[model samples]
Structures are given as structure tokens and as C-alpha cells.
Target chain A: MIMGNLGFLLYGNLVLIVILYLYLYKIRKIIGFQLGMNISMLVGGFGAIATGVLLIYQFPLKFVIVTMITAVIGMLIGAIFGALFDYQTLLTGYINGLMMGMMAPMVGAAANNSVLFLLFIEVVFLFSLVLVFLSAKNT
Target chain B: MNISQFLFVLFCLNGVIGLLFYVVMYKKRKLFTDRFGMVMAMVGSGILSFNLAMMLFFMFPFNLGTLAIISTMVGGGIGILYGALTRFQSLLAGFSQGSLGAIMGTMFGAVVENPALCGLPAAYFIDVEQHMMLFSLFGTGLVISTFGLLFYSLRV
Candidate 1:
């Protein structure tokens, strides 16, 4: 049962990230540097946290590997998103993502055995994604 | 040197770097506009405090709550120091980011030290010391590179 839920969450997160990427690509030209910085930071930080938590939950034993993977994932996501706008934004996003990624696994591990907390994180992640989309659309 | 000594050296080194950066920024605080100053404060304090907190936690792993508080305070103090050169807005940003980074760093250190605290199996207990050393080294490198970037930004 847990495995099924984890699978669903992981795939869903991937889809959302891809969708976000496409959306950002579509609107990259329209967004300013400030918005770009915020967008990149949001995506990188939350994406890292989600990925770290979900993966850690799936594989409890490979803690070190999971941490490294999540950190890389977060850094990549942030850099990619930030690259759309300005160099400084790229730097900001990269550092923010790195920090969040480094911290995410421990958070996930701390909430061990609590599927509900995972679900809560997922909800919050989705909500933030929606907020980002709305904010981008407004600008 | 052993893990503890290595961590101690790293900790002192991080602090010195932070101080150097602070002094450099202070000397040229007039050159930075509001936005640049805010960014510098936020990034500098956050990263510095994060590395410091992590090393401190690794050094003293017994008192989790106390360490967390100490790291948080240290982070906030660093933030204030950096942000003081700028406006109130920068101060706010630095303080919050610094505290957040410190909290996260302490948590990471705690989890690495005692995987059991996070409900993980203690299979890697023997490797915990190595992990601590590796992470501290990585953090030191991160601080150095970031300060270098900040200094470069000053040049540009």
C-alpha cells in the first residue's frame, strides 16, 4: 500500500515538474528577473524537498545516496529555471536549491512512518506550484 | 587529523572567512546599492551560518535542542552583522534566511550523527564519523567558493 502511494506521488511530482518546465519555457520571455528569481527558488526548493522526502521514504536504507541525488536534483532544477532569465537569478536559485536539498532528506527522515505528513507535503507542494503559476500569469 | 580536529579546523576556518567577507563588505558597503547589499547579506549570512551550525552540531551531538538554539542565534547574529550595512529590508531578509539555514544545518547534522533519530536502521553507524568529515569538508569548499563569487561580484 505504501509503495503504491509512493509510486503515485513520485510520478505525479515528475509530471508536475515537467509541466512547470514547459510553462516556464513558454513564458520565460515575458517574466522579469525578480520574478525569475522567485520562480526558480520556489521550484528548486520545493521540488528538492518533495523528491528527497519521497525517495527517502521509498528507500530507507540508502540514506547517503538519496541525499546526494536529491541535492543534485534540486541544484539542476534551480539552475535550469534560473538560466531562463539572469545570471544573478541563476546564482540565487542555485544556492537556495542546494541549501534546501541538503536539508530535505533529514526532514523526510524525521517524519518517518508518517504517510499523512508526506501527503501534507504533497498538498503544500501542489499549492505552491499553483501559486507560482498564478503569479506568473498575473505578471 | 581525526574527525573532531578536522571539524574544529573547518569551523574556525568558516568563521574566519565569514569575518573576512564581512570586513570586506563593510569597507565597501557604500559601493553597494540596496538590492545588492540585501542579496549579499542574505547569501553570505545564510551560507556562513549553515556551515557553522552543521560543524558545531557535529562537534557536540548530545544536546540537540541546545545546539539548534545556539546555531540559530549564531546565524541570526551573522545576518544582523551583514544586514546592518544596508536598509531594514536587507536586515529582515538576512535574519530570516540565516535562522532558517542554521535550523536546517543543525537538523542535518543531528540526522547524520544518529540515523536512528530519524528512524533509519543503524547499519551505517560505523561510517557516521566519515560522513561527518566528508560533509564538513564539502561545506568548507562551498563556503570558500561562495565567498569567492561574492568577491568577484564586487569586482564586477
Candidate 2:
């Protein structure tokens, strides 16, 4: 049952991503990357807030803190991307958010130790930062 | 249900609703009321900030709660300013809807947890109930604002 649910989720996420991509592609001419980034940041930020509240309600304070921090950092990176390449930045944020939002709670559930959780957060944060920076610089 | 299952539902709802709203907004951008967009942005930000603040306060210390509210307000203020300067309805509309969704999600999760809080002491119970009521009221306002921004952009 769990595997089936996961499959369904994976498929749903895939469809959402394709739809988002199509929309972004269609609007490339009408709305530039920067503008899209700005809009996406607002959308992404609120989404992060909702997720944070939900996580905090269910998980331990320490784990939720780490997760929220990671989310905020990711959104910041997305905002920067919006400044550099608006639509792409929003797309990247959207995709990353969908994946991370689905994963963070499970990860938090498994986070029994403080040190491991901190390390996990640090790794995720650094990796996202690097990815966003590289994407921004290269594109 | 467990946290994972709960969050999965929230994630799915967010994705589906966002896609639907974006499609509609994209198709009718030219017809959307520009004047109310800014108002919606401000109201959404305020709702989101208050909801976040209460959540933080309930879960953590005052410091984190203060920081979250301040940052959210600043972010919303900046978005509103940028939207006005650029004459971009998208910025305002996006922020408004995003904040509205965030608050709504938070409210839903709170309601899920509300039954557990019924056995608290009198003072804490009153305090917690007050915050919940405030958050719900704000959520309602945001809902009205979002719908207003969506279909009632034009005056009769």
C-alpha cells in the first residue's frame, strides 16, 4: 500500500512538473524570467510557511527548526535565481519545493539524533546553495 | 493520520489548486482588476504573517516568532512595492494567493490539532483559543480577498 501510494504521488508530481514547465514555456515571451522569479518567490515563500507550520505541529522542535531553516535558505536561493533568470528560477524552486516538501517530513521522522539532523540540514542547504549559484552563474 | 500522510495531502492540494489558479489567472490576466491587487497583497501578507507568528509562538520562543513575522512583513512590503513600481498585477496576485494558501494550510493543521488542546489549563486554553480564533478570522479575510482579487476585480 505504501509503495502504491508513493507511486501515485510520484506520478502526480511528474504531471504537476510537466504542467508547470508548459506554463513557464508558454509565458517566456509574455513574462520574463525576473518577473516570474519574483512571483514564484512569493508563491514559494507562502508554501514554505504552510509546510513549516505543518511540520512543526507534527515533528520535534529541533527537527522542524532544521527543516524550516533549510526551506528558508532554499527560497532565498530561488529568489536570487528569480533576479538572474526569473522563469527558470521559479521553475527550479517549484520543482525543488515539490520534492523537498515531500521528503522533509519523512527525513525528520528518521532524524533521531541532533548531530545527524544538523549534518543532514547542512548538507542539504549547502548542496542547494551550490546548485542555485551554479545555475545562476552558468545561465 | 501520520505527519507524512497529512503533508502528502497538503502537498497534493497545494499543487493542484495552484495549477488551477495559475491557469485561470494566466488566461484572464488582462481582465483582472488591477486596483485591488495591491490591497490583496497587503492583506495576504498580514494574514500569513500573523498565522506564522502565532504558530511560532505556540511552538517555539518569542524570538523566532518575532523574526518570522518581521521577515514576512518585510517580504510582503517589498513585493507590494515592486508590484506597484513595475505595474505588475502578477506580483501582487501571486503573493496574495500564496499567503492565503499558507494561512489556510496552517489553519487546517491547527484545526486538526485543536481537539488535543481542549484539556489545557484555563489561562493557556483561553490564550490558545484566542490565537486560533484570530488566525481563523484572518484566514476568512484572506479567502475573501483572494476571491475578490480573482473574479471581482472590476466595479459594477
**What tens-digit string does per-residue lDDT give for candidate 1 at B1-156?**
877788888888998899888888888988888878777887888888888998999888569889988989999999998999979999998999899989988888888887888888878698998888878887888789778877888766
lDDT of 2 by residue, B53-137 (tens): 3343334334433545554554455335323422466476545544443443433333323423222123333344444444344
Model 2: residue A118 alpha-carbon error in angstroms: 3.9
Pairs of residues clashing in candidate 1: none
Interface RMSD to the true structure, each candidate: 1.9, 11.5
Per-residue alpha-carbon lDDT of model 1 for A26-51, expressed as tens digits? Answer: 98899998898899999999999999
Please list the residue runs of candidate 1 whose C-alpha ends up more than 4 Å from where it truly belongs after superposition.
A1-12
What are the runs in model 2 whose C-alpha is more than 4 Å off? A1-115, B1-107, B110-112, B115-127, B140-156
Judged by whole-model lDDT over C-alpha atoms, candidate 2 comes out at 0.41
Model 2 steric clash total: 3
